[model samples]
Target: MADSPEDTIAAIATPPGFGGVGVVRISGPNTAALARAILGRLPAPRHATYAPFLGEQGETLDDGIALFFPGPRSYTGEDTLELQGHGGPVVLDLLLSRCLALGCRAARPGEFTERAFLNGRLDLAQAEAVADLIEAGSAQAARSARRALEGALSHEVNALLDALTGLRVSVEAALDFPDEDVDILREAQVQARLADLSGRIDRLIRGAAQGALLREGLRLVIAGRPNAGKSSLLNRLVRREAAIVTHIPGTTRDVLRETVSLDGLPLHLVDTAGLRESDDPVEQEGIRRAWAEIEAADAVLLVVDDALGEGEEEAAIRARLPGHLPVICVHNKIDLTGRVPGKQGGVLYLSAQDGQGVDSLREHLKAQAGFSGGEGLFLARRRHLDALTRTAGHVATARDALAVGAGPELVAEDLRLAQETLGEITGRFSSDDLLGRIFSTFCIGK
Candidate 1:
């Protein structure tokens, strides 16, 4: 692995397989030399020049466009080279091999982006957004990731850090003058400022939760008694024959999972075995697995036959589910029961066979996940949420200390902790282990 930003690294920037064009990216101190060695002489800065890629024997490897970007003004704040050539796998591999032979080592997964973060071209949050943008599953997710890459999340974190710093400064100053008549806690608006900071953190946390949902999505478990149209509902949601639909009660004997996006939000639909007591051992094991899925699910969709309405089985399953878990009661096969196709009193009446009232269920799912599509959402991860929550906790403790007239030393320490926690979100104060784990998930050449 390239240990330092000074080390030169190269990789195939584009994805694998044949395409019209492929790009090989090189960055670090050796970029200028490597470019000159391959292209005969360094190309003008930021300008693409048609050139021939030559092997060590001075023989033509392939003709392509070469562009050079000098240090401190480039993506990684270092000299960078991009060679655009035919997308043929062998040709691209040869080009990369030629560059490696010229003293450029292969780039590690996410190393290019890691270098960008190290050089201050992008902060930690923005660096993660680069990967998020590449892996975004929906148009909304892409837009959200783009906003985060533009430093939307870092901006909020930095603002919170600044506020904490200001509060700490005031407290430290007051500590220096122990005999002052007016306490800094009272004069500096410490309590009010802390309250406002706490509120701001709360609002940011809400937005981040939604963004996280956009990224990781919700695990939606479809569960109920046997022959409750569970397979039909799963098929309808995914718009395919994903699950084996049959009138037989025990047709589905195992869990089937499919991920579907609902208006930019992703729902990991898990079609589980019917939840009913059975004499057969196979059916019993399936029910056990269904319960396991329900336990881990973020939300549950309880599908009940509209003709059967609510019954002992439905009530039993609902009672068995975790109290905190969100459940959307779905009344499937409404076309047979002559029931209205809409949501009424927390229950969605829909027909899975003909796809009636499914839109209401989708809306209810969105509402359950608290995903209200809006602008300016920053792509966030679970780690970011944990940091924000910790920061808020520290702020709350600091506020409590101030409210009770606690000494400036204690209040100041709490504020400092709060500031540090916020810094972790943007990598202003992060551990080496955290950095390694975050970057390791990215694909090579990112």
Candidate 2:
């Protein structure tokens, strides 16, 4: 179904500032009327017509290309118009003002895409991929976003939903026909199917987890005693002198952060002050902040100077780190120790000063992040992961119930819950508030 044409909306679709060309997009029932008024004639549907844009007083505002898409075929599944003109801000503003003056209201942020979703042109996940594609930081991320927009994730989710639906029907049928001698719930074939479904859900969860990692990169915090080459390691990872390198201990009295793409994976690296008891108030504050970063980090790179080896100080730092967080023990300054650069016993040995063994650290970080080079991947948000996790939990519970010969009602309820939870990913089951919150984060015109 297409959106109603009565309440038309308009926006400058192109980004702000000067460019080779700018575009003003309009959609609604009034699109044709607006086109005739501005372009002097309704453009041929889906054709690019060169024309002059006219103001209220019959004056030429700008000369450019006008494109029209009729209802049920446009992006919003409504009558749509796009005016391509010069990229100057003033020119675009004049064009937009002319649109508003012609009774088209300015579009809300992401209203265009929202309308498309509402009109059944795209599902919720694909709509989100529109924004992810625009903000993608790497080629891999962009490709993943494109795949998601093309319905890769939605297809898998719907397949799971279909399987769940079939299982639910069979369970309910068994409940309805209690006189049957052979109990479907206790059948070996049914149990096998349930196990297979659980396996499929687990596989989807792993893929979604990887996609989530690609969407939101890892936060890695570097921590150790002063002058352990923590700052040098940060500089080496980012390929820049992002942090000050000094011989003096406690030279870095604050946290320094740098974002770098490590093999198509976004790596947020934070360098913190040397962790130790300090008499100075400023250094004490720095140490406090450093611990705070470690607490919130996805992983920590615990740097240990090769000269110092794994001493009491390193042990103490290890004891303080969060037990659940992944900690990569980095043995730095291996050049001086004449040790080869590589990973040994889950610890990375390298020289940050000489750029030795950094590649090993990169691979280790990627492995820790569960990033698989973005192949067969799709962009996913934290909410998507949450939904997938919840769905998997419900499916597992259903399988367990089936194994225990639980009542059909219990199994059916679990299957139903799992289906609905999975549906949230593509918005087959969603609330208005959730939709509002998701679209609000998108930029205007998209």
Candidate 3:
């Protein structure tokens, strides 16, 4: 971790591969000294200079561009150096070795961004957006992450925090002056303010839920009896033959998974073996795995033969599914049944073979995941949603306490807890373990 300003850290910033150029990044108090040792002269602040990188023995190791950024105005709010050179595994490794020899320790995963957070260059939500932007599954996701990185989410949180602080101060003032006739908790204006804050938090929570769905995506399990075109449906959704499709009843004896984007929403598609009893050990094992997948899926797409409609096997399979899991009855092979290709009453009639009604399925999946392709959505994580939920809970408690004419102290305490919960979203009140968990998920040299 980049926890100290004195401990210089370095790492190959560019991904490992032979490219036109690669970079070695170093940051800390000793960055200037390391640059002087490796480049023979310190580059001008915030300027890139073409220079020869040298080893300890004063031998030229590589020719590259050197950039220097002085502390307090850099990415990590510390002196940082970037050495750009030919992107070769051997060459980059040699350059990194030279930096280590010059007293720079290797940086941990996301240490660069972590340092930026600790140094106040970015809040927790913004820091997380860095990783989200890097690993965005779609353009919409990238846009959302960019909004979060630009302080869209943090701005909302700060505004809510300010409101909470103001209300808490008012309550405390009334508590301090018992001699005064000011009944802060019972005041209509105070109740209105609390109601306004709650409404704002509610709107933010809805947007955050959509953002979280975009980030984590939905896990959909496709299961049905043999010859129900389960594999065909999977192939149509993925736009390729991801799963082997055949006329055989039990052709597929394993669960196949493919991740695809449906209208900018990531869908983790799982195609399981046809759900049924089988004497063959392989088929039995596949059925077992299919049930396991159904148990954990966010949603299930039960593909059934339109000719047979819902039968005993379908009922049996449905009975095994987790009661809480949402199911979309997919009447596959509708082409053969002469049924129109569309959705009605929560059932989708489609032919997976000729792509009939697949678009409706895609739309249904997006709707089920609660994704709306729109602007102003900031990327958020589960923890952020949890914090917002807790904040809302506290605010609701305070509202109720005031409505019932509870003591000013109780209302103030609820407001205080609400403020602290909101602080966690922007990293103002995060635990060390939470920080470690959040940063460790990022790639090295972030």
Candidate 4:
């Protein structure tokens, strides 16, 4: 949709369902007029007043609390109104219809937050955090999203940008005045400043990577021969019978996915069919799909029967795993082997049937994700990580350029590019298409 602050927008702010209360939101220059037409009078700014919501013929459609927020101080940085009434779908629709009849257009998804970003009330990162907070799956994810909404990530990015700007100014100044007796770059310690900036960016990259992990979680695939306790491991990790546990080979002929929270980190576990050559078309197809899942997974859990031990078949499975993907070899059924449940030779030894050594596997997954709980973490998206990574690359290039006695012009350009790249996270250098793609994912009435 077009960015039109002049046009009034209204929507059912609450989710589409029956609840104790639902909110119909309105914002624009016409908010005052709409309030007068619907509420009979504009309620005091930021104050909730109980009133009857009027219809076209001045009929009382519903009675609820009306709240008015004048321009520049509201969520959208414009005149905003909210109607809190009974949450029946019909009632909410009636209230929304009244607003529409009085000159308010229906709000598109994320229009409210989009307006907030455009009106300078929140940066892009904070606007995205608003949605992240709503979609957070765990307490730690919620806390991280809250921190980001409160400008934790933005503060760090802005500080880095400011420092980079200052360094760029020094480098450019040296370029402008070549005949000066004083080497401005040397005097200002440009090299040291660049080095320091690079170090800070590196740290930020690491933190953002962790935050990204918290946001996106990990897609782990459990792959092995049939009846190797892969399904048992899946059910054990999720603490439920998510997959069928049968002694028959190839009992699991398809991929089954379940999500579990490991101390706040979301683990998307996929139990795939056993990987073994079979003449049956259905079994062959399952094996093909299993390999497909393995190719797309972030990590693989290669479960093997400890009683059977690692044979040539297990070695072949390990050999087929993607080299870049992290693979955790799980030696299950330790109970059958009369061995203690623990980790040995970096391979997890566990009995999935009786829940032995599962806790260790949980810790291993968390550690592999680099997630240390919510403590001081900020929620981040893949785009944020990508921007930071590109910024780091540019900064490193500039540092190398400076070290190699490169001209001030070349160093200044690289620093400028680095600053611009960093600005993408905060919308300073973002494109319209980027904003559209980012905000479109948010639910309506946000």
Candidate 5:
């Protein structure tokens, strides 16, 4: 494959596994040339043609559908070609080799998506949402990613930028006419607008926080005294005999983790060694690792035996957990204890064996993560949060500068800085290196 910047990029467009249909995608100025070389004729632009895909030696590799999308309106804004063929690894490899032989280079990870963002076919945030949508772990997460891909998040960012641009233009006009001696006090009006914008950005940041939570999900550690049915609860939650549940104390000597979704919120649930003094070295090491997990978790599930009561046992365990780590106290074996399975404050009573009260606990967990079980939620990344934080900080600085009557020129600098920070979220102010890092994480042929 040539290293020329204008060389066409090609890749298998489906998952690396057997399927009913597999697709090879190509995009660049050389798309039509490759299509002619491989398919024996140029594919009709924006149309599908059934044909026998061929190699350079005119060997029939697989008969498939060829589709073409001319530059400007297509994804990546470049001449594009797609070959849908039988989903076999051998067939895909041969077809890919043929494309390479015809002067089409293999695409890098996320190259297609990167090109799309670079060509203005999609904003940076929306481009990221495409990958998020593919990797979504829950229906809620997928819906959120779809909303973001549809421009819900980018629309808000663009609206904020437009307002900031207007304010910047006004300040620049005042700067151009220094002889007018524009009273800095009059800039209060602009400062007020910046403050309002900052408030809105705050709201968006909070919403994005919830979106990120739904995307990254919660890491929950189950820790409590020995014989609290922690293992049983884990098995029940995961709906399998994943752990060895026994009556003997200190039975679980290691940590067990499983990824589970509760009411559409993904969570990494960890069943750790019960937290208590132990004579065995293995149990001690497990306790140490359990604490480490508890510290790192986004939330903790303190499992307590309802039949045994939760007074001093629960207190000792709570004292060991890191402050600020959210905990949900579970009174397991509620059926045996005759306590109704329900949630009160931060405590949830449930019989792990019978599967009672699991629904209420799942609902509570989702509510804690800001999931309302609706389609309005949209996926967001940590990068967006950082940009919003920076933007909010700049907007605040500009407001302070105006309130003190420092100068319209100074306030204007803050406003411009805020705009740049906000622009980075959607690549309006992004550098090539940042763009490279973001797109390189995506699967090929995005």
Candidate 6:
């Protein structure tokens, strides 16, 4: 992701397919010269003008619009040019080759946006949202990513930074006058302010957590005995026949996985082989993989056949659950049992064949994952969440110090660490390794 100080980068911006038009994006100090060589003349800054892109041997590569954006006010904060031409891959390649022949290097993935970050046009969180919005699987995910792209998350972080800075000022002031008669640490106003800041930090942490869930979604694994309606329930939820359903036990001896969005949160639902001891080597290996999935899954869904009653099969299923996992026990085949489908003690009774009580099951899954949101939440990445968690831990340590009547020196040290941790979120305090990782995830034409 490193860029030379003087190298100009170019790339075909449109997706690789036939289309009405494609874009050749270029950025660097030499963009104007490349534009002039390809278009025969430089178009007005930030204006589109029709031009014929010429190639070697004076052949017309393509005719399209030429747009130029001078440096420091463009997407990458550098002189940039956009050449729009026919969507044919060959035509786009000819235009790109023409630009390269005139001294422009092909852009690496995420090089465009990385330059934007380095130029101070956007922060780390906002830059990531650009990628998230492009790859969002649902309308809700796209909307949330747009909010982060608009700086919603950065604004909140900045607000927290300001609060932390003010508190540091007060704490240091108190430390300066150690012998004063008035107890600065014990003052009612000071305690009230500190409590308010802590509460706000908690609220921000909760919001970021929800945003992270929306971005990455939750992983759910369905495990149960044979003939327990696991495949039936999966097919019913996806509203299609993605898995083969049979009355025979042990029909599904391999893992079947699907991605579905339920109520705005993406769900990676996996249907595993029935958890039973089998002499068949394939089935035994499948059962082992099922337990591995259960260990890493955010939630485990246990399916039970209600008509069959809780016999040895059901007992085996219950015994397989890992310690401290959120389990959604499902009692399938409720329609045949003549009982209404509902939840009782974290278990839901339903009929997967008839699609009965699936709505309630989806809601339960979301609630268990803490996804009580659709809009108004900013998209967040794992790195951003880690920073928030680290900063919050420091705040918690400072609160504990306050409770024990610790000296201002200890409290100030904790606050300083918290401030630096938060600063890393916005690149105010970050290592080059972190920057490289963040920008490497983006595409070349971003």
- The Cα RMSD of model 5 versus the native structure comes to 5.8
TM-score leader: 3
Best by lDDT: 3
lDDT (Cα, 0-100) at 24 in candidate 2: 97
| Backbone clashes, candidate 4 | 0
- Candidate 5 similarity to native, TM-score: 0.86
Q: Give the Å shift of residue 260 in candidate 3.
A: 1.3
lDDT against true structure, model 5 = 0.82
Q: How well is each residue in 1-446 modelled by candidate 3, as lDDT tens digits? A: 54565789999989888999999999999998899999889999988899999988999999989989998899999999999999998999999999998888999889999999999999999999999988887787789999999998999999999999999998887788865456743367789999999999999999899888878778898879988998778777777423222111123433476677776677877776655579999878877776776677899899999999999999988887799998899998888999999998878999999998999888888888888967877889888999999999999999999889888899999999999999999999999999998888887888
lDDT of 4: 0.85
Q: Model 6: what TM-score?
A: 0.87
For model 4, how does the per-residue alpha-carbon lDDT over 1-446 read when each residue is reduced to its tens digit?
56476899999999898999999999999999999999888899999899999989989999999999998999999999999999999999999988888878999889999999999999999999998888887788889999999998899999999999999888877877785466743744988888889899889888888888888788898878778998778878777423222111123433466666777777877776545679999878867776676687789898999888778877777788888888888999988888777788889989999988888888888888777875999999999999999999998898888777788888999999999999999999999899989888888898
Compose the digit string of candidate 5's lDDT tens values, residues 156-259.
99999999999889777777776444645447567677778988999899888878877777778888778888887777766642222211112343346666
TM per candidate comes to 0.88, 0.86, 0.91, 0.89, 0.86, 0.87
Give the per-residue lDDT digits (tens) of candidate 2, residues 191-267. Answer: 78778887887887787787778877898988788889898888788784232221111234334666677766778
| Model 6: CA > 4 A from native | 177-179, 182-190, 240-255, 274-294, 314-321, 403-405
Off by over 4 Å in 3: 1-5, 184-186, 240-255, 274-294
Per-candidate local distance difference test: 0.86, 0.84, 0.86, 0.85, 0.82, 0.82
Off by over 4 Å in 5: 1-4, 178-185, 225-227, 238-255, 273-294, 310-321, 344-346
Instruction: Please say which candidate is ahead in lDDT: 1 or 6.
Output: 1
**Root-mean-square deviation of each candidate, in angstroms?**
5.4, 5.8, 5.2, 5.2, 5.8, 5.3
